[model samples]
Target: MSGAPAGRAVAWLPVARPLTLVPAPPPEAAAAALGTVWPALRRALAGDAPLAVLPAGAGPADAARAVLRPDRPLEPGTDLVVVTSGSTGGGKGVLLSAAALRASAAATLGRLGGPGSWLLALPTSAVGGLQVLVRSALADREPAVLDRGEPLAAALARLPAGDRRYTALVPTQLRRYLADEPDALASFDGIVVGGAATDPALLARARAAGVRLHTSYGMSETAGGCVYDGVPLDGVGVRVAEGVELTGPVLAHGYRLDPAATGEAFADGWFRTRDAGSLAADGTLTVHGRLDDVVISGGVNVAPQAVEAALREHPSVADAVVTGRPDPEWGQRVVAGVVPAPGAVPELAELRPWVAARLGAAAAPRELHLLDSVPTLHTGKPDRRAVARLHGGDQ
Candidate 1:
């Protein structure tokens, strides 16, 4: 291979006929599928061609249909195609180069002390999981595939130990480990957790469980994570205006064939993330959710995450997700979906004041819904669209 072989998805670069790396359910099978698809992939790999990596269930059609990107033309030196489904269900493929992938993996390895094996806990179809495979490939190490169905401890025990061990996980995966025994959590030398916003409590608990948790912030466009534990990795840049703007080596080339969207997203080489965030005096970035997440309630803009965070502070509430439901009086009323802790029952009356005391009445949930568990995508991020449907609400 000309460039260092990328993760599980790009591993197929040498084999598959410029096909999308589809992510099937259960990360282990997706991780294992890479090897099984190798022969076909290996044959395809011979052409030294560039490939597009789309989400699973994209298509089996050849590159003409699969990669004939009219939205944003693939630039020279591009080798990876990643799809990012936006909040509106309108998605686009983010074009990344081999240089970008290596830069990201190198920055990660540098931050973590050195290269080593990785625990593949996310779907290979996604950039998060793909990066793990890429990093492993660059190090010439085999990654340990964690089956979501198995016990985390047992799965971890099976991974071959190496000089420097690391794993990538989303908040949902980290939450599971926070409950496991301490030793099981300590097995990884470094745990690079990203994919979606992470609750501070979850990170604290993970650390308490002996996990060297590093909260990361990035997306497919960044080739994975450009920030680790609130620090931008080497050669990466971060600044917040109305939202976060990320630049530097880790940044993606642009969207595949979508000039309008690409121009809107990448201006002056800085990719503008629609996430509302701020920089501290020390330059730590604190994300406040998406710009669209702000809801108008009674002629005032209220952040649902603020209400959600306040509700989740209740001992009876194990987890909380907040959204807006249409209301004639308020335009959009604040709504909360809560998961109760064991032996605890959360009530609207109890929750309202809990949030009111901390965040005032404007931040209190006008409607309450106690859930068994939050609805999540297969990749383990909150399925807010599904949650909205669960409450008969639309945003």
Candidate 2:
């Protein structure tokens, strides 16, 4: 890592020689970079050195030049800054302490029944993928990586067997993997899925197929996910304000060099999330959707995810993205773009009753369109802006 200082928020960048920065290498090299973060992070936490893990296409020297300043030194104990997946909007660097990472790793392992080897399938630049490295590092084990360029099944075939296999995947990846190679996915001892809200129908199918799926909730600010499978890990706390608020050892120090952004998101030791959810009396946290997810349709707040989830239940629908289109009469009309199953083209006539039966008339899509696939960001998450554009026939 170049240009990044070793101490938390110290003016190390100005005083010390321009350091090497950790380039966010391509996915092909993500697994290989797993070992690099440990020592650098250790040094950073112990001495307050700042380590910036730059995403691919950028080099270590860039982070130093971009954010390092004598006026804003990282606080003591700040270790690593992982970039957020800007799927919703712009990405930001989240600063986390060594203790936060350790707490996350320990709590995760305790929840998952001791330490085991993890497989790297998600990008190392993202917290989901980086935490895989962190967990594996803490366990003193090397994780297997499935290069992004290759087919998932082929990559799984290349993985070393004989140890308990664990991996984290976004819902899209898991759904595709389960459809393509059920046996291979079932071979894993655990599979953590996040990055977006998962449909209940999908989860049921996964469970029936014997996939140990764990849905997680948290952003980079929470050091990845402090809540796994609707339950908070040890030392993790959850509260519901306008949305969900989390306080725990896994919380990040703050956003790097962006106090205004940090102050707004983190306060009273709790990191507030954009997701709208509720906490059950038994401690189950049910995340409905993002607070910004609602679209006013005919004077009613409509959650497109709920509509999309219902659409996915159709046998002919392989995947779906639901959005609201502005209409003169309705204000916003619900529309759905569906990736049809092999040889299936869903029509609105049949799809309407299908959704209305489950989610009521208001939630039913007013229009249905066939799509080859859903538009996604590099992080393999749905590009909502682009998807919304698709509603206007922006192919």
Candidate 3:
């Protein structure tokens, strides 16, 4: 085991002396470094072993190896464990393997024209953020990390003009960047938006502003995103029977120390995503919403995604998330949390009829909450749990 300071904002060059207990090896310098660390990372996450991982704001010398007691035995194939954003339920650690992560990285690089220098706007702890780091390391280029809380324009200014600069962002970040600094959005060769549903209008606006935005679909089990701009990357397969189940080399081994979850997630070698989606005729995967996101109101299944898509058409609505709230009469009711466009305010009454006409009355939201900003997970997806918690009680 080795220790080193996490790289800084501009260039993420390694710092600190390498320790024998926890050897600090650069993933870029050694293609097999991830494989070398995979076993340790797996054991550490499984609670069967202890390893030192540098926490945020901690220096290299502060690294300490702490043992994690296993509640249960981790399955044999587990290699890496990643915790999901605990929105709907308590966060569960997802298990993956070095092979899966590497395969995903290879597929992504193949589809995205191989990697170059990446701009790290998101944190590395997240699957998406980790993908960025992995891609940069595989490409042997140090990513430029954006200063925390820095304006989008200021962050864009740091990168020198290049033919291949890439970055990943959530829909909210895309909306804010498009609204505040449209020109800045065009600086990157490619911009990936995912983690939550992205409003069509925002995508249109970004495209109009000359931003090459691509919507991604995947989760931690698949080693970040395996789909780009609706199309599954080479070697990634999408099937929608029962739910959106993905099959490919990128699928993870299983959940660490949770055989039940691992069995539930892996069926016939395909990862069964809780998300509901459809694969188009041309192989594009259009994700509708989560399987659990559907609201049963008066015995009718109300798709929140339908309502959210309809509301997003409104010029004033920059982003929208619709969820179900427990209701005594109808069992559940549709509610929406909306982020308005710059200098614009949303009127629920005016927007109701518009949504009703598009998605039908049953799918239209009964209550609309205008938010200054939509809550997002570290992965850049909408915090649906937060939205439900904030507005669900009222309904």
Candidate 4:
């Protein structure tokens, strides 16, 4: 146990308590199920048996239960357990207190002006999606939940028009909305995009089309996006040592039933985010990418995200992902998987020089695979491991 502040008792770590697991309904059934889950959500937030809401791809309840281990005891004060792969692509249960979740929602609404009706476009399993519901509940309004394949216009129109309308989206969803129904996107007072980094070019396009966009950076550990538009939220703090670290009241308590992992991630009231970044003198954060995402080719270190950004700037590329592949000569080669712009087929020859100009020769992709669409997780983040396999590379 750690020492508590004056007049407060030290909260012992790893208190044992069981939690209920609520497997989220499939996308088609989610709208109808929202009403049923809302009451349970309220109870959970109020410190009833805490709930772990599983994501859709989690399969059947038995399968989810196997992975989540609902029978295992959780820490005291944990009101919600969010199962997330995060940036590492390994599943873990993040233990969030009701206070932390509420703090995050309050800070988000305060940052976006005030509380308002929200449009739930992302899956409820992820923190981003759950935060929308959490915000809506706190504001005393039901969110307009978007079913799978629902049009953005139709979804936005579902919300009551009076209060400030807001929504959260991943970069893939934002890109699609910008291309297909930018008018609908512009209707929102604010849009929070996260789950992965938003491309600079995509941000420019959305802003040009009159969309109010906030780029978010955080994970389940912070209850979802403590940083918006490079600035930390009201009480959230950002610092960089070996990697980015965030300190705030909105952070989760720790990982449920994984003390070893939790101990490594959280310490001294700060969560060590495994992302390489820098903080400007003005306190703005510029994320360099994940510390583990660097690829070394021919003794030159290359950041895949930087290469991906360069690729996206190419006129013929709609989207791109860079992964490192084992090579006998270079030790590791930078490989690219690209989704071409409509009616455009970009060649490796054209892209090689294109990226080399912006980044460097080592950063340029040695191999290119033209994909019809980038493989993405249900959370709308590009599946980097799957993207690596596109060119037969091991992730």
Best by lDDT: 4
Q: Model 3: clashing residue pairs? A: 1-21, 1-22, 1-23, 2-22, 2-23
Q: Assess each prediction's global lDDT (C-alpha) against the native.
A: 0.73, 0.76, 0.69, 0.85
Q: Name model 3 segments beyond 4 Å from true.
A: 1-79, 160-163, 315-318, 340-345, 392-395
What lDDT is obtained when candidate 2 is compared to the true structure?
A: 0.76
TM-score on alpha carbons, each prediction:
0.85, 0.85, 0.78, 0.92
Give the range of the ten consecutive residues with the poorest summed lDDT in model 2: 12-21
Question: 2 or 4: which has the higher lDDT?
Answer: 4
- Model 4 Cα lDDT, one tens digit per residue, 1-395: 65667797766676566687666777887685476556667877788768877666535344446657866666778898887754456677888988998999999999999999998887777788889989998999988888888888998888997889999998888988899999999999999999898888889999999999999999989999999999999999999999999999999888867889989999999999889999999999999888888899999989888898899889999988888999999989999999999899999999999999988899989989888888876566777887776667875
Q: In angstroms, how far off is 333's CA in candidate 2?
A: 2.0
Best by TM-score: 4
What number of clashing residue pairs does each candidate have, in the order they appear? 17, 17, 5, 0
lDDT score at residue 201, model 1, on the 0-100 scale: 66
Q: How would you encode candidate 1's per-residue C-alpha lDDT over 94-138 as one tens digit per residue? A: 777777888898889999889887777787656787788778767
TM-score of 2: 0.85
> Candidate 2, 144: how far from true, in Å?
0.7
Per-residue C-alpha lDDT of model 3 across residues 363-389, encoded as one tens digit per residue: 777778998877765455667788888
> What C-alpha root-mean-square deviation, in Å, does candidate 1 show against the real structure?
7.4
TM-score (C-alpha) between model 3 and the true structure: 0.78
